[model samples]
Target: MKRVAIFLSVLMLVSASLSYQFYGLPYLQKVDDFTLTDHNGKKVKLSDFRDKIVLVFFGYTFCPDVCPATMLRIKETLENLGDYKKYVKVLFISVDPERDTPEKLKEYVNFYDKDGTIIGLTGTPEEIKKVARSFRAFYEKVPVKDNPEVGYLMDHTAYIYLLDNRGLLKLIYSPRKDNPKRIAEDIIQMIKLLKMEK
Candidate 1:
């Protein structure tokens, strides 16, 4: 009984610490460094974006609805940030790197932002799998009867990650929200806090 009680105590403490870490009390597990090719074929390291607030989303280009809608919301949220954009970056990493070649990803990202506020990235299946696992993201392919050549559908986590300038995780948001402006406000607040920290 005493051992069980102690274990529970430790579990609670660990949970609280993790929450604070991701929530900015300085206790979250930082993502391990990784190198993946961006939509432009430029090599990008997760650590390269250091000192910039990054919003990371995992999805594939061919997602029937969720991916596109979430990306649009992300774009809108960044736009809503206004002058503070200098400190923030939006990253869309593809889970289906097998199909999402660098060139194709580049075209998709460009369609959303001409100036390139949003960047798309893809890599080998193994590399992408490693990164996705680190982020605790899950993605699976769903077969379609008509599209046998190209996997018809992909089911993946639809949450967006809000990371501080130092790459510490902060907030998770759903794709379908009543007011995206609220999300923008949260991001703005995080940016302000990060700026103050620096």
Candidate 2:
């Protein structure tokens, strides 16, 4: 069945990702310390979360399916971790900055995290572009030919990027795999590994 095939594929990716000592994780490619205006209207830098593990995702408020679903899985991951969620930070970056202003971003992100568990960020298109490029993520706007008033939609990368407490990039998760539980488990293991190293 189609679902079985997808599960198997996700299982394979998860298996590979668990081998943290191997190729599933990123090395020392440091992310740039970019400034962002967060949903709370606060100027935040990526470095602000240095002591916590950061999970970053790129999408827009107008996303029809993937964004919300991915966010839900992330929330579930946090719930699964229970009290340990305090050690993690989730950041949603708007790929469509034109319509996702700071005010709009606050409402959108709050819908997913009423307790302010996730912070949404939007900046000038140029600033967002620089940030996206820094993370090696890509996004583009596709215009709607049928209705001008309907506006446009964005095509973007859907990987959830994980950065360790020390600010080093660790793993990138695929939402389409529908295996966030495994991803969360991997993250917890990584957290333990990091703790032991300290």
Candidate 3:
């Protein structure tokens, strides 16, 4: 009886540790609601997407490589979702608010998202900073040397944030490590988990 009790206690501890480390429940950060202008020149709030599994990415339209590649990966993730895609929402938030006007954002995101489902967001510098701070996302402006037309570039974090239907951040994925298929599977699993909670 003593051995059985000890074994059960160990098992319970291990199970909880695994759940906390892998599942990101009870301790995951809850994203605060933020309002920003979408590509369509409309004010959009994070709470507006409460019913969706939102994927938030921070990047600029002028990015030479990372932004475009990550956007394509997100597009592929949506494609992989198929019928489940409707339950997901992608928000491409531009860190370069000085250059990424609403019109430019619309053109940029439209190039990849033909269906117009992906929403590109930009806001005033202060507003962008507030939102970035909420996600702990970093971005800095670096001036280009001897570049007359190209101007400066933004150095920003590349992590993709996954928020549950209730706007609670549940996962963070690296474009360099996790592929679209893996992300899609995670989203589907998250959907199942949320449904079970209900």
Return the top candidate by lDDT.
3
Give a tens-digit lDDT track for model 2, residues 132-161. 998899899999888788678899999888
| Index of the highest-TM-score prediction | 3
TM-score of 1: 0.81
Compared with the true structure, the alpha-carbon lDDT of candidate 3 equals 0.84
Candidate ranking under TM-score, highest first, comes to: 3, 2, 1
Q: In model 1, which residue pairs have backbone atoms overlapping below 3 Å?
A: 21-27, 21-28
Which runs of model 3 end up more than 4 angstroms from their true locations? 1-27, 196-198
lDDT of 3 by residue, 1-198 (tens): 645644554454355456543322222566789999999999999999988899999999999999999998889899999878878899999999999999999999998888866999999999999999999999999999899688899999998898878777767887665588878877777776566233
Candidate 1 off by > 4 Å: 1-27, 176-178, 196-198
Candidate 2, run of 10 with poorest lDDT: 20-29
- Which lDDT values do the candidates have, in the order given? 0.75, 0.79, 0.84
Model with the higher TM-score, candidate 2 or 3: 3
